[model samples]
Target chain A: MDIVIGVDIGGTKTKIGLVDQNGECLEQTFFRTQDFPNLTNYLDQIKITSDELIQKLGKEVNILGCGIGAPNASSKNGTIENASNLVWKESVPIIEKLKERMPMPMRIMNDASAAALGEMLFGGAKNMTDFIVITLGTGFGAGIVANGKLIDGYDGFAGELGHVDMTLGDGRLTGLGVRGGLEAYVSATGLKRTIMYMLSKYMVESRFRDVAYNDLHGEDITKAAEEGDEIALKAFDYTARVMGLALANFTAFTQPEAFILMGGLTNSGKWIMEPLERYFNANLLEVYKGKVKLMYSKMEGKTAAICGAAALIWEIQDKPS
Target chain B: MDIVIGVDIGGTKTKIGLVDQNGECLEQTFFRTQDFPNLTNYLDQIKITSDELIQKLGKEVNILGCGIGAPNASSKNGTIENASNLVWKESVPIIEKLKERMPMPMRIMNDASAAALGEMLFGGAKNMTDFIVITLGTGFGAGIVANGKLIDGYDGFAGELGHVDMTLGDGRLTGLGVRGGLEAYVSATGLKRTIMYMLSKYMVESRFRDVAYNDLHGEDITKAAEEGDEIALKAFDYTARVMGLALANFTAFTQPEAFILMGGLTNSGKWIMEPLERYFNANLLEVYKGKVKLMYSKMEGKTAAICGAAALIWEIQDKPS
Candidate 1:
């Protein structure tokens, strides 16, 4: 049996899995990323865990390659650059270090791009040649596909859609210290800010008024909206308006076939989708009106990230060299 | 000798040139586009004029194919769809009609896309794989190249940067009846509107106040700015500010190596360039701050369009199909 190792590196935890060609995860394990502060030790642990997974299979197996998805990873340089969330704050030469211990053809990309490739390979965008996979988690991120290929851009730093400025000078500041960026108004943190604003602006009764700002979470807002909270619904509407208008502008750039939503914020479901769909179409240019579809990612739960990482290997393998 | 027929179809006139592989025009001629309101007659005139140009060359030349650049033209469908400026109000099946008179491997694309291709084949972007060409004529248009290919989008209707919404709703109305689009702020007509707005808003003394809105042209503003007319200078400042900010947002999309400015408005020279450069760099995300260069088109004067159109044939011929 031939298999590939897929690694998904998060700030707090790291997931590793043995994924076969059919998009099945044969075995999986995780380790605390913060525990291994040193880069070399961290890579060594990945090798050890991957070997343990193969040994547990209890049969003859061939290791094809490895693929990794990480924050701020550059596919061109094969390094992770300025990933502030991680303990290893400097640029990590991940590919160079990993190759010495567990050698095979490997690739690394930003997590959002890996998820897009995952969507193209084994999810809702399987048949789509041109589409965008937007990951709306703690922050906003996008992976663009056009002409049936990922837009790696000149320096492999493309698809930084989160930081794209949404307003001239009068919006919230993003993590990058930029004001009025898309991420400032469209992410999980953005939703919380909106709820806070609504609480102050409107005299309408809402459960959110009782909760402290830092105590609130995206799930709490979603729950409140599910219970017909006015402030929560209004927050979703405001976020949807910003997202829809930004997407309409993005449509002018690539005119993609569809946009697939992914990550934690998508858990809000119809609260976000219904309004986003309506605003997206309403803001589009005349020619692109009613042509683009909006949908949710089909890759479900824990295995999705591992499968996305593994899809990177298949993508490279299938390319005409 | 081998050559291709390059046709540049404008609203009022059409230019035809016999071009060789080296991007040299061997012979050229023109015919009034509005002279014949009928589509068939216009295409017939094109074929006749092209034959006359080839005969004038006075040599045995192998005609490779014909390539056309026109407004609202689709390279995929080989038709001109809803080109309002042209007398033919309906979608014109240009390739199908031209094939009957002059048959060969032909291609057609919108004028901006053709100009970008021309820049790749013959101008400043010859060595660049990723770049954007912005045509600042009476309206704003753009052609984006990423991963060494044109971003034609899913339905071949990509690169409509002109209509990308620049404001939430506070800006001017565009020709498409949309409010606050990039075209409404960054174009020649947009400059006139800006001048008019400046005259009404500020008590600054200027020559522009004497000129009515209908009689104003882009060059008039440029000439006035050259003489240090405060209102005209302010108008250019306002236009440049809008364009620079828009380009900053655009940079986040593809991270192109450069942005080449073309068309009539670029003739404003330092009146636009100096301030545009300052604002563009200031507004760019930190990662892309100093990486992207802004340049003017290397293909100059009337011959630029003809060369751009001819480059299309070479582009198709060179592809590894």
Candidate 2:
């Protein structure tokens, strides 16, 4: 079967995998992405990983396509345009350079958009035409699939749902001048803020207090919530409320069939999902009360991101050149 | 040239017209819609108007289709559901009934959806693939056209931008039963409330005091503003600011090409548009600071609705049916 290589480049780690038609990944490799000083160095590491994977497979597999999923990748420009998390000076032509090195048809998309396509192809929202996929990582990120197609508007910046203002009046302030953006109260950073507020109010002492501010991770907080920690539970509750209200607002506007929640924090499952479902149902239109289901990503472990990036190639396989 | 019959059914009037492929209305007629107590009466009036129009202008014209625009119409079901202003008891099979009466293929869609399609086809957003059409009438309504298609979700209930809860805290007692909704703060009824609040704050008396509460009209307030009234301008400014912020929030999410403003209140022009534009620009993402445009609808008066309704049929024509 013809296979394509999928590369998911993140700030902390990078995943590479070989995927075929049905979104099945045969083999995958993981590496620390932060070891590289610049993008070219990062590309060199990716190339080495890809070559190693190809050599280990034995058979000379036909490389049909390649897809790169990066943090701030601009699909329209086919470059990673100054991802603050990644050490890039300006726009990095990863796709162009990769194409020259491997000599195969290739495309690149933002990580959230790629993850959304992966969800539509293989994860919770499989077979659904209209849905939303949100990556609840460092900051909340969203990609919209409307009327069965990805919403890549002029300049390919259509589905920035994370920036949709959540609070109206003199509420929370976002990094941007805008107040109450979805990311301001729903992302990993937002969750930390929620936890700090809860900690101050409840006067609770926890292991989290010993962790450095920058080192405080979402996984650690989720672990705390899973252990029935009240402060962590409050944090999850606040995140669920903000996220649920955001989802309800999005549903009222777009009326999607489902909302697929992804990223690290969702590992807490019932802690976040149960409360989110409750708030979402309460806030949704009466007719749409139970129609839209809130689902979690089915794909887990190292292969999900690479598998999603590979799914992007399969999606555009039949498109007119 | 192939032509289509466009019909706009409103609470007080029913407008029927012959529209050509170029979106030009060749012949038109209007009748009192409120006089009809049953669906049969309404259908019969349409029959009378259709026959008269055909008889006056040769009956052998190449009529391509018929399209109806109505309040609370469902593009998915092709029915006019129970609209608050209408006397209908339940959902009316508008498309099927009209097709039977006229013996022609027809389609039906919501007035807001039709207006959005009209703007895409013949109004200010002629070349835009992604834009929102906001109708500022009795209620705040929106029709979102994204990626060159109307976002009719699972139940054709998408693009309810008006119902998105605007109030943040204890929304149950607020205007839309959950904080501030676009309709709660932007519609004619909402604007009336704004005027009333302003009147109480400023303790001003004008022609507004002369008109009884129930009989008060949106135009009367606009006329007062037109004659250089401060209280009326303040009322308009509040609406403009809120609407501007709403648009900013919308653009951040969808990143549409433009915002095509329609409906009656839009007649106020700069009184609302200037401040709305200012607030919207101030709150937009940095990259999108000067990118998105805001424009008024080119199609106005009764024909606007008719042309907009006809656009649904034109849209279907371009689809792979």
Superposed by TM-score, candidate 2 places the C-alpha of residue B269 at a distance from the truth, in angstroms, of: 0.7
Report the C-alpha lDDT of model 1 over B1-321, residue by residue, as the tens digit.
Answer: 999899988765688998888788878878888898988888889989998998899999998899898866778899887664478865788999899989888889887788889889988999998899898776677888998888888876788887777775457787666667888888777888999999999998888778889899888899999999999899889888889888988887888999999877788899999889988988887767788999998887566678889999988778788
| Top DockQ model | 1
- Identify the CAPRI category of the predicted complex in candidate 2: medium
Deviation from native of the Cα of residue A127 in model 2, angstroms: 2.8
Please identify model 2 stretches exceeding 4 Å from their true place. A31-37, A55-59, A82-104, A123-126, A175-177, A202-215, B1-3, B10-14, B29-65, B82-92, B96-103, B124-126, B169-178, B200-215, B314-321
The positional error of residue A51 in candidate 1, measured at the CA in angstroms, is 6.4
Q: What's model 2's overall lDDT?
A: 0.77
How would you encode candidate 2's per-residue C-alpha lDDT over A1-321 as one tens digit per residue?
588899988766788999878888888898887788776777778888988888888786988888887765778878876564566656688888877678887888877788889888877777888888878765577778888887776666666666667656456665544577777678777888887777778877776667766777888888898787888888899889888888888886778898877776676678888998888888876546677978777777467778879988888786886
Error of 2 at B271 (Å): 1.1
True contacts kept of each: 0.56, 0.56
TM-score for the first chain in candidate 1 comes to 0.89
Cα lDDT tens digits for candidate 2, B1-321: 577788888765788888777788778889888788788878988989977886777756887788887876777888876565478856788778877778877888777888888878877788888888888776667888888888877777777777777555433122335566677678676677788777778866666656565776778778888997777788899888778878887875667888888776787777888888888888776646787888888876658878887786776777787
lDDT of 1 by residue, A1-321 (tens): 888889988765688998888788889889999899988899999999999988887778888899998866788999887664477865789999999998898999877788889888888888888898887866777888988888877777778788777765447777766677888789887899899989989999999889999899889999999999999999999999989988988888888999988877898999998999988988887667878989888877577778888888977777787
Q: What TM-score, computed on C-alpha atoms, does each candidate reach?
A: 0.90, 0.88
What DockQ, between 0 and 1, does each candidate earn? 0.58, 0.52
